[model samples]
Target: MKYSTSPTPSLNNYPRSTSPLPAPANYQPTTASAAVKRYKYIRRLFKFNQMDFEFAAWQMVYLFVSPQKVFRNFNYRKHTKSQFARDDPAFLVLLSVWLFLSSICLGLAMTLTAGKVALFVLFVVFVDFIGAGVVVSTLLWYVSNKYLRRDQDGPDVEWGYAFDVHINAFFPPLSLLHFFQIVLFENVLFRETFLSCLVANSFWLASIIYYLYITFLGYSNYGKLVDSDLPMLQNARVFLLPLPVLVLSYLATLAMGWNLSEMLMHFYKMRVLQ
Candidate 1:
């Protein structure tokens, strides 16, 4: 007689595992509102291992030389992910790191006390960059959603997207004002001569222009993405309206013997050392 056969165990016959599955390493909660998404982003600020800093560095580079390419990728993101603004906060994190290091370098270049240097870094990272960025982003978010949209019935711009645009535009200016200016300050741009004014004002001029160009690109790209009634970038030139006025102001500063770089240094000293 054959041995009695035992019934084989089946996965279905066995109770299914009741434990919850872990989310993806790159999991994003797209269904959340902008505020909730921002809270999540803020939560990830300290999780360095989860960040995509390599891509953030690439964004920093392209944001300077070929911002068009950067925005092109934003378009692709919209098509693939159903959003134009970045979900990853890696760029913001990397920028903060860079600003901290640059602020330290600036303090060293200026021969600042350690306490002063620390204070300066805090001021730049928290007050100048983040604080100002929040205000500017809020203003633009309100303005763009309220006034710039071609379709009032369609979806309005996200506040996070406005902040993303602000940070994107802010990066190039930070490199110029915070990094490159430190290099020039030891010998050249710190002088009180009219030539110093010319150089310093030129930096401001270039910074503002870059900021406007990137801002224009950001809003214009959004307009194009939304399939507006007007042609691409028709109203985007509004960002550039300040250019001619900026040039005139630059010339006026030169005429008036205003060394903006020196003024900026003094402002920093007053804020930090005092």
Candidate 2:
């Protein structure tokens, strides 16, 4: 009996089956493209998560030292968005280390020059630089985030985590400067020279005004994601909202010091008149 059998399969021209199809030929993934693709995917998946404070802190420190980075991101939309998204705890910790190191070095330098009149001037100048830092920190985030809004896909919201991160990181520098000006100077340098006290007074006054302005601005615009959403600046009195009672309380203490000084001067004048 002749049984018809299927023609023997030929090795040539027959499709070879493997465990799985090899990745397509002509699918060339260069490193740059892969990185870019990865970045985009990560950005979308990113959330403030539990690490938001840490991320935001690093961003503040990074942007503080490298204004150029913020500026570049301002010009480039992708960078701004990526930056805003990846803000996480690990990054903030690194930044805190850097800011802490910076603060320590500044404090040490101040310590080394503790008793010198020239040191007082340097301290005064240093305080001014600290004030500048505050302005720059606030400005970099405000501007970078503003630029990010240009092509935003959804409603703009303040990354509260980032804002908090910044506040936490920023408070250190501000507090350090305040300590140097108030306690350090008052205890050591103020009695040395009239000029020293005058400079310290100016620094203190400037600091008070600066703090009030920044605090007011922070609360007034705290939840405002858009410019139009801002309450009328004149009518809103947004400044009163952030409980600056602590700051106000501090101011009251200073006022009492001034009043006591005035009373002493008045008593001295009466004695001379008698």
Best by lDDT: 1
Against the true structure, candidate 1 has what lDDT? 0.77
Segments in model 1 whose C-alpha atoms lie over 4 Å from true places: 1-30, 223-234
For all predicted structures, in order, the TM-scores are 0.83, 0.33
Give a tens-digit lDDT track for model 2, residues 23-126. Answer: 22211222234356446545744454545565345445554354233323221222224222233344535444444544444444444333342343343344
Clashes of each: 0, 4
Q: Against the true structure, whose TM-score is highest?
A: 1
By TM-score, how accurate is candidate 2? Answer: 0.33
Candidate 1 on 1-274: residue-level lDDT in tens?
Answer: 7876998778767422232223221113356676776787788887888889999999999998899878766755654565667868899988888889888988777779898899899999889998999999999888877777767775667777788889999999888887897786557788767777888878888999999999988888773432222312236678879888988998898899998878888888888877
Worst 10 residues of 1 by lDDT: 19-28
TM-score of 1: 0.83
